[model samples]
Target chain A: MPVVGMVGGGQLARMTAAAAVGLGATFRVLAESANESAALVTHDVAIGSHLSLPDIAAFAAECDVITFDHEHVPGAILAELESAGVLVRPGSAALGYTQNKLAMRERLSSLGVPCPRFAPVVSVADVEKFAAGSWPVVLKAVRGGYDGKGVWVCDSAVEAAEVISHGIPLLAEEFVPFRRELAALVAMSPSGQGAAYPVVQTIQVDGICREVIAPAPGLDPDLAIEAEAMALGIAAQLGVTGLLAVELFETRAGGLLANELAMRPHNSGHWTIEGAVTSQFEQHLRAVLDLPLGSCVPAGTFTVMANLLGGTDPDVFDRYIHVMAADPTVKVHFYGKEVRQGRKIGHVTIVGGPGDSVESLRDRARRAASYLRWGTEDGE
Target chain B: MPVVGMVGGGQLARMTAAAAVGLGATFRVLAESANESAALVTHDVAIGSHLSLPDIAAFAAECDVITFDHEHVPGAILAELESAGVLVRPGSAALGYTQNKLAMRERLSSLGVPCPRFAPVVSVADVEKFAAGSWPVVLKAVRGGYDGKGVWVCDSAVEAAEVISHGIPLLAEEFVPFRRELAALVAMSPSGQGAAYPVVQTIQVDGICREVIAPAPGLDPDLAIEAEAMALGIAAQLGVTGLLAVELFETRAGGLLANELAMRPHNSGHWTIEGAVTSQFEQHLRAVLDLPLGSCVPAGTFTVMANLLGGTDPDVFDRYIHVMAADPTVKVHFYGKEVRQGRKIGHVTIVGGPGDSVESLRDRARRAASYLRWGTEDGE
Candidate 1:
């Protein structure tokens, strides 16, 4: 059996481990602690930090291919593994683009990909200069930021300078006044075969993904095709060997501007678990293994996925029985984590048939997710 | 986390472990060896035989509820566990019917469920007498027989006498010349709620289930409804708390006769893994855990599942890439076992769309299974 080593032990890795079992592939996870979601279920877990070179080397020694559950692993460590012939997928070069916002902007812009105009900033002066063309610019940390962290919207140079006192490497970009956010996910094998999932409308609140609807209901056929083509183009250009999520701004003017990039399984694709011909997690495993990719066609007419953020309820398991009994069609996924306010503990997916309304699917998923989080059917 | 301890470590337990992860439930398996299929993937494995009383006790103590992967766990041991207050789903009384074919036949007959005429025999003379009425009788060992083992079809008293010399507890039954074999799978909860899956046609090769087609193509609608009703009635009567697979023979006269019973996940329902809204393995977990059972509605227009029996090839992983590439929609499941001649190593399932032909679906599943078993697309 070929061993696939994952560098993180989050819910993404937990799901990947489940998919690995079906593939008859041995899965190993390097966890910072035994309590991480994936570590709790995976059989082979190495308790180590991603920052430790020796830990990375030890974990890589046992795997036929090394991949990641998150892109937080330093680029130097991944580069080291690659030099040692460890077969790190979505290799360090591709990860470098996702790891740093400025690098991704530069690369995509240079490739003539549609993207928000951006420039690396040393001080507020640079931000002011960039804002000369577009006011109310968005300033984001170059690296090590996620879920609303390390990002700020500044209307003027003084406001941007005050926020920059945190001393983080910053990049300024044109604030996209988009009608909605969409994500196009694609999986590519090392052998150059790629498969694209339908473009999905992603709802984000406080920079945390709240829900996703597949195929972006009523999306223009031409724009959907263009988004998929753009995502595929980026994956090819980056030589990304697993799932690549291109978060885009669907501007009111009917054009797409690249917003962000994620090179692993993304929250926007969670609906694929039950709604698509092949799940993104399964496709990622196949891609990293250089195996033939599975079909990415939608299995149902519509799919709605809602994240279950941790609320006051400490025991989500108690609510499972109720949620399941309420809607037998809703698929529930729980990430084994201690309940902390606003943390993502799990998600619910509801797939609708051709005759079913998307509004009903979305309501059912949201209701199920709310019940799980609050232990009430009214979905407060 | 509530721990579910399973008493056997076959593919049934392996699939259940995967489902348990989705439920955020802790799954523990008591395996006879470390090399059992479920033992390889499951994290909490007790390497002890189910036959050992102390081992069963130790395993049961760690679990909130107990179940079985196979019906081979001795009834007395289960009774002892029950006496000790360990919760065992489908309790010892229910498993008793499945463990002893004569017991199942007797119970079904007394309950007025249709079944073949059967009699327990102690000697060759008794077998000879039973065969006198039927001409050709099927003799089966009363216990510990599976996959065509311990079964013999004797045409005459002389042949019956020769086969009975094997010295196993035997039962003789009238051989029903049937049109085909069918299975009705139902999931029941301790609360008396029951859900039935679609009746399926099962193809048996040498008593081993080789293929199964859901909703039994060309099956009479009335007969299908009757089969489901019978299965649900049997589950409620037997007090079976998990999955009950009631294998039946559709007589040449269009009547249905009970053929066999399995008190756990059965091979015939494997198609539900991808073909139905809820998989049998997931439903089993829900039923055993006393949670609400999921929907049993089929997810596709049709589904065909084919077992991948081990052939001359020892390396199944090598053929997986080809099988997956050949048919991306075929869901492959490997038992993670070394290949041996005629052993069931894995299975493949294919779901058809609204416009797809069942024949094409069956052909695709068979070709995938054959390629996995023999590395040939022509299924030779």
Candidate 2:
């Protein structure tokens, strides 16, 4: 029975807490506020900032190992804790790549991993040089970017310059025309064991993930194996101890390129809660505890997950009963966060059996999610 | 979302709390102690006795609807709460039959349900008369008994007198020469909607449930349907809301007979956690909340659930890592309770897909459970 301390209390921590209950593990989370998603449902929560070294250190003291819900803790703080002999999974050196896009790109590129051509942009001149090869370049913050925030697709140098004017550390990458977004979610143990879930296709709306389809329908078998291998390789190379979600771009040319890296459980793997034999949350705990990883086999032929983003209605539960009645098979997950427009309040997932149409599953998931958000069968 | 308050915070409440996290509902538990299984992991817990009327009242005040983890709550207490306008699912009237075996047998027999011939035993003469047609008879306490407690198989009038002399309100039943024990688990909403899970055969050791096999292998399809219909009819007839697990006796002649009833989540339905599309815990919550009951379809063709009773080892986690590695597909659920010999510490379940043998699944589940209880796979 190990005590796993998770930093940054959010939905990931909330779901992980639920998963930990089955494993007979004591899970503790450090939240910035008592009202955070994880704090609302879990018993052991320390109200503190991830940014404060003292808060993290105090929180880490009681746990056998410390993991993260989000990789937002300053690297210096993580490094300090490690130096003081605290067992931090996905330690500072590996976390640096996820915390900084520029570092991730450089490391992946050096490791011969397929990744977008990118460069650090300290000034507008750098952005201009990077975008010279392509008119519409993707500009990403070097740090503190999530859920489509701090990211800008610049059509021209003028747009890139305007974004850089905010004085945030930025990076410029050549925007590739991709067929669709894919995610390779893998977990690694300190014992060097790694397990990869089936690669899944993630649908993005305005850069925020809206839906996810497991096993990436009609994905080339060879390509799927390659993606899984690449993720496991990246996890091993980066010394990642827990879950690593490698977001990829499935290029139109039938090639794959790494897009982003998440050192903790990512939104893309949320479908695994019902789709895979071992959910990412549970896998993360096994990895962090240095225990053997569970099976990553798919439980169904196809599974679709739809994010329940808050809409005009701040009451997410207003149509919950209707949604449950409409689709009894759809599994709903709420984060216990107050609903605000465009915020990810919860998600819905539907696991399809053999001969079950993926479109039908996706439609059911979406319909339920929409009804919860808009109180209508459709999102009208 | 509605708040669900469950009295008696054992493993059942602990598991229901885990399921509650996904439904966006607030779950609070009334536990006899702060360290009860459910109280340890759940955020909202009232460390109070279910027997205390004031404690139950206070706990029920915060909940939209109240349910039970166990049937130990007094009928008078529940009646008092109901009279005061507190919403209690599986109201006292329905729970009465479950609490008192004699009442259950009498009601089921009157409802035309097949049951063992029985008579209330007020004295040794009463037991002698009931056992006049048979040498061996079954004796059960009318109330406050669980597992093997308050139950006995009496041989001859001498043994019957010993049991009846205890004078704790007893009932005499003709010994059922059954092939195996089966349980029909079903859930009913307050709106009268009902859902029945596949009939499962339960294996008991020393009158304690040891393992459960979903769908009762080799069972006649018609009989399965009949069992389900009978359970549903009983649920409606008794006005039982939430979950009703009807323990049944399948005679050597293929006839089914009612054995016992549990108005709350029962051990026989624990396999539903991983074996069914909607777990019993989640279904109980939905039914008590008056929401539409989720589908009761089996997630896999066959599932084997093996209870992990504490053995010589008080340290249950000693071999947990080994068990996880041995059977990655086996799902483990542990109650946050200290291990004591013969106490139920946890359970391990394995779901079988098409072409998977029930024997193999049962063996795997048993091996994992034994390993968790003892340090060795064979419980050596």
Candidate 3:
């Protein structure tokens, strides 16, 4: 029996626990507390802080391999675990690059990967020189950033100077107007076998993910093929064992430039749960376990996923029935979380076949969220 | 916020927990321990014996409504709970009929429902009377029987005497040479509304379900309609509040006889999880909660399901990758159980459109089980 240990106990860990049920795998979770999320389903739950190495070592001893739900594990501890021979998916060496974008951009550029032109900028002088020829520049912190945080856009150099004093490692690059956003997800086994899911377009609102449309909805065959190729190339080059989600910017010149990367599961690939024959969660587990990959075709011709955000009330979870009663075909997954404003509580996924209208799918997804979060249809 | 309390913690409870997630209902389990059988995903589990009414009440106090995974709840306690206003679904009156075969037969016969002619046989003379014209007769215990247990076939009065002496409240009935076994399931609400799922052919080996063919391949249109009508009639007449599974014995003479009734979700309806527009589990939750019923139309062109039995070795649970790697579309569900011989450990369901061969479907289901249980590709 293989006992798998996970570092975090959030929704990602909750979903992975659900997938682990099929293989009869035992999942041990190191939650921050006894009542933390995902503690309901895991076989063994150890309440401990992430920075406690003894606690992590105790949790890891009960499992054959260790993985992570978030990228907050320090590189020093990861290296210590690796030296002590605990199998870690996405080892510290490969994850270090993505943890800090400055290292990733410089490394990928040297390796001949197509990345946006950028230079390290710690002061106003550095930012002005980088944007001298370019009219607009985007400034980003190399670490501790997610969901559009730690980012600033300057139409001129003066705007960059005000944000430079934050003292985080900064990278300034020329801002290019892109046609659309695309994400390519790749899973590679420890033994070098790999599989790629179809590229999808991500829709964001107020710096939060809202939906994902497979094949970017209207992507040509050539572009789709190119996306898969680029994604697989990065996974193989980085020796990424589990999953790699690379965000791309479709330049006006018809080429894709690397925008960002997530070394673990990302919001862009959530559609794979219902759309693909093999879900990304299953694929990631198989890859890390050194097992064979499954098929990677969409379960239906078209699929759309909408995230469920937490509502204002503390009892927002009571609205789940109203949504499920209206549309039984919609698949809803809820994370057992305390509700507050703007927190991701769950998601609804609906798959439609070829020629299915996007508006109808979108309506169903939104209605499901509305019904589950706020009881908008309660009186009716 | 409906907190539903379930008496038995098993696979059925596990599935009910899955459905409760979608409906935003909470589930509390009364089992021997937190890991008795269904501690994987329940809301809160009370560790105590079900026979202890105080323990049961303590569990029920946290629930607004009470239900059961199996028909093993004591009638007296249920009556007590009913008197206390706990809202026991299917109520004690309805459940008592299904709890005892003798009572079920008598009620069905009085209601003009089609059933095999039977007679209570306390002595060999009674068996001789019933077997005078019939060469063979079926003898069954009145209660506490399932999965080929407590049933026997007698070709002579002497044989019948030996079997009937095994228990009190036994009966003898004329045996029917049935062409096949079929099941019709219906979900009825407290408001008198009911929905019927498609009739499915049940393949039994040694009285255990092996595979189920949804819509009962090659069934006549009239017969199919009649099956649905009969199921609805039975459910409405019985005032069933959740699922009612009617097991039918189809005689060679083209007639149907009632074999048994299950007042909750049955194995035959497992195919609906992935094959129908709405799964039976979700429908059951809706009906019991008095929510609107969903359409019972088949989602794909066909659906097939097979049960997976656990073997002796406990380590056999780690074969998740082999089965998934073989066919990712084959949905396998496992009940977190310690392996036991001949025990129903889990099941696999397959859904596809027309042109999928029955042999292939059967092979896929069996192969998944074989892979999970023995780590062998014998079925493949």
Candidate 4:
């Protein structure tokens, strides 16, 4: 058995700890506080900051391999750990690109991977030049941006100047009009064994992922195969040892363009916990431990996962029983976090059976999540 | 979220803790040592003995409801807790029947449940009279027996006398020519809600369960329904609030006979972790907490579970990688315990998909378990 140390203690780490128990692996999480989600469940936890090199080095000393729950650790810290002979899955070289969006776009573009046209932004002049072809342009912080944060859609140079005055490193990109968002999740081991889950269509509300449908309903089989290949190829090209989730934009032209790269388990793959033969959490562990990857075959016809964002209700457990009673087949997962308005509290998954339609499964999942969040079938 | 306290820290509690995390429930286990299976994984563990009244009382103080990982707690201690107004699922009165074999048999017989002919054995004459119509009768200890221990087969009066000479409480039963052993697992909530899993055929060697095949291949559908109904009826009649595992002997006469009773999560239901829509561990948590029970539908066509008992190899993990690589679809669950010859260390499960035969699935599961246990596919 291997001791897997994760760098962050969010829900991803919490779910990964559950998977580690089944695999007979000793899991340790380096969390920021004792009350963090993973810290509450796993026995072996080190309370520390991921940004502190000394804190991470001390935690990594007791583990066979170190991974991440979120891509927030500075690349320099991971590089230092690697220099100290610590086994860091998805090593510093690979994580560098994910930490900086400008670097990721440059690397993918150089590798001939389809992506949005982009340029580094030092001033409003750079943004104006980049937006020459389009009126509205997407300005993204070069680092530390997640869930719609640190991003602004500028309609003109005046708006761009306002965002640029914040004095944060930024990048400019073409605002591609896309039909929907799709995510291709792939896991690769150090031994070069790779496995890819089905591409899923993700629905985002205000830039936060709200729902996901596996196999991206009505997707061309050829396109799904191509997407999987592209993700696996990216993992191999980037020398990634764990999970790499490539969020893509399905353009109206029926082409796929990579939108973002997440070097750990992403929200779009949460449905795989019940929909796929092997969960992403378990696969990530196997990858980091250099063990054989489990099969990524879908377990059912369709699986719909709905994110349970906190609504007006702070105490959602009162509504939990109601949702459980209303649907016996829907699976609920909760992160041990205090609920706040619009915060991601948990998720609901519904796997479609033999005669079940994708629409029906989505509706069931949505209803359960909505009830748990707002105490209503429909989010009012 | 509610705090769930399990009295014993075995593999059952370890798996239950995994489920508890998914439901956002706080789980605590009382273990004799820090290295117990459940204690190793769960953070909130109390180093105490179930036999110690004071220790149990302290553990119960932190829990909203108390449950058992095994039926080894003394009835008197649980009774004391109940008198103190502590909430104990499968209250002492119901657990008493599971603790004493003679009492369980008598109560089932009185309830018109089909069972083997049996009587208390105060002397050799009782065994002789009970075996008048048969030879090689089964002698069982009335309490504290598991996995072939505290059980004996008496060929004549002399052997019966030798077992009785030990002076432990004993019971005599007629030898049954059973076709095969089947287990019906049912869960009931304090609210009187009941859910039954598919009947599974259990293969045993020397009274130790080795493998379980869900739905009892080739079993009559009507008989499966009858077995489920009978088990549910028994749970209600006995006032069992958590889980009741009814072990049955399908006699050569095509009738089911009650064999044994377990009021906690039993080995026979381990397959439900991956086979059923709702795992037995999760169901037990929901039942004891009086939350709505999840559906018990099979997740696939068929599922086979093979126990991984330690063989001559003291380090079974040396062979684990081989098993994981050989079959990616087979799910392995290890109970973090030291490997001792013939001791249950883990289990392997394979869920059959379309075009898969029950035999093929069984072979895959058995091969994985055997390889991990003995470093050979055939257990040579």
* DockQ of each model vs. true complex: 0.75, 0.87, 0.38, 0.87
| Regions of candidate 2 where Cα sits further than 4 Å from its true position | none
DockQ of 2: 0.87
What TM-score does chain B alone reach in each candidate, compared with the true chain B?
0.97, 0.98, 0.95, 0.98
Displacement of residue B361 (Cα, Å) in model 1 is 0.5
TM-score of chain B of 1: 0.97
In model 2, the Cα lDDT at residue A89 comes to 93
DockQ of 4: 0.87
User: Clashes in model 4: which pairs?
Assistant: none
Candidate with the larger TM-score of 1 and 3: 1
lDDT by residue (B61-104, candidate 3, tens digit) is 88877777888888898889888778889888889977888888
Sort by DockQ, best first: what order? 2, 4, 1, 3
Fnat per predicted structure, each in turn: 0.65, 0.88, 0.31, 0.81
Instruction: Tell me each candidate's RMSD, in Å, in order.
Output: 1.3, 1.2, 3.1, 1.1
Error of 3 at B372 (Å): 4.6
CAPRI category for model 1:
medium
lDDT of 1 by residue, A152-268 (tens): 889887789887888989998889899999999999999999999999999999999999999799999999999999999999999999999999999989899999999999999
Q: How well is candidate 1 docked (DockQ)?
A: 0.75
How should the candidates be ordered by lDDT, best one leading? 4, 2, 1, 3
lDDT per model vs. reference: 0.90, 0.91, 0.78, 0.92
Q: Rank the candidates by TM-score, best first.
A: 4, 2, 1, 3
